[model samples]
Target: MSRNELVRICRSNSIESYLQDSKDVQYCSRDKPLIQFFKLNTNAAIDGDTDGLGGIIRDSSGKEFAAFSVKLPAEAIHVLEMKAILLGARLAAEKGLTYTLLESDSLTAVNVISEVWTCPWKAIPVLADIRDALFCLNNWKLSHVWREANTAADFLSKPTCCIKRVDIPVVDLPIDLLDIIVADSNGTIYPRL
Candidate 1:
C-alpha cells in the first residue's frame, strides 16, 4: 500500500483490503516471533470441492520447528481456520513448546479466538477445542496478519490427495514450501507484479 492509502486506513480505523490494485497485492515476509517464543502461522483454504488446512511453527529465529498440511471436509472458512489453529496448538504442546504466538490471515478466526467478537455458532465446537489446546501452553497470543505475510501456509493449504496428510519438520518439508521458508528467513520480499 502507498503512504497516503495507509494513512487513510489508519485515520478511518478500518481496512477493507490492503491492495495497491484489485488485481495485485504487495508481497512481504512473515515477522519472527519474540525471543523464546514460537510463531505458528496457520491458514485455511478451499481447493476444488475440498477444504484444506495448513500451519507452520517456527522458533524465535525463524527456523521451522514443524509444519502441517491436512485435508478436511468442506466447511465454513471460519470453522476450518479454527481447526487449523487448534491443530497447530496441539502440535506445539506435543513438542513441549511453552510460549507461542499464533498468527492467521483470517481476521475472523483471530477475533473469535481472542474473544474480540462473539463466537459464531458454526465455529463454537472447533473454537472450544482450540481453547483447550491453547490452555496447555504456558503463554500465547493470537494475531492477525495480511495474507501476503503468510505465503508459505497459504500455499500449503491446497488440498492434497485423500487421506494424504503431511505433518513434518523443516528438513522434510516439500521443496515448494522449503523455498518459501528460505526466502522468509533471508528477508526476501516478493513483489506481486
Candidate 2:
C-alpha cells in the first residue's frame, strides 16, 4: 500500500479497533500480583535548553503509590521520556517489585524501550539503564497509554513555582490530580487528537 493510503487507514481506525484485529498483542494481565502502571511526561523549558520530566507509579488497583518529578539538563522530549522510564524502573527495583507494567504516553519512547523500534542515539544510555533495571524484575511489560489516561503524570511533569531542581517524591496525591485519578479508575474515556 502507498504511504498516503496507510496514513489514511490508520487515521480512520481507532487504536481499540486495531488491537481487536490483532490476536498476538495483549495490553494488560489481570493475574499479575504487582502491576506498576507508570506514566511519563516531558516539558520543554522557556529557554528551550532543559526539560522537566515527570512520572507517576500506580498499583494494579489504580492507586497512586509513588511519583517523581525531575529536571534534566537536556531538552529532548524523547530523551526525557526515556529517562522517566528509567527512573520508574529504578524505583520499582528499589521497592523490590517483581512484576511491573510500565505505561507511558509517548509511544515513541515505549516502542524503543520495548524494542518495537530502534533506540535513538541520544537515548541509548538511558535505555540501557532501563533495561538493566528491568532485569531486576521477574517480569515487566511496557505499553502505551493515552495522555488523558495519564493526566496525573502530565500534571506532575510541568515545572512548578515551588519545586526546585531536585526530584520530589510525591507522598500524597495533589488536590488537583484527585479528580483525574478518580476518572482514570472509573475508566473514563477522553478522546485524543
Judge candidate 1 at residue 2 and give its lDDT.
Answer: 76
TM-score of every prediction relative to native: 0.80, 0.70
Clashing pairs in 2: none
Q: Clash number for model 2? A: 0
Model 1: residues >4 Å from true position, as ranges?
A: 1-27, 161-169, 190-193
Lowest-scoring 10 consecutive residues by lDDT in candidate 1? 10-19
What are the per-residue Cα lDDT tens digits for candidate 2 across 1-193?
A: 4434433444433455554455553232112124443332222222255566666566666666666776667557888888777877787777776767777778999999889999999989988898898898787778777665567667667666224322234445567766666656555444343
Quantify all predictions' global Cα lDDT against the true fold. Answer: 0.79, 0.62
lDDT of 1 by residue, 125-173 (tens): 8988998999999998889988877887787787862323344534556
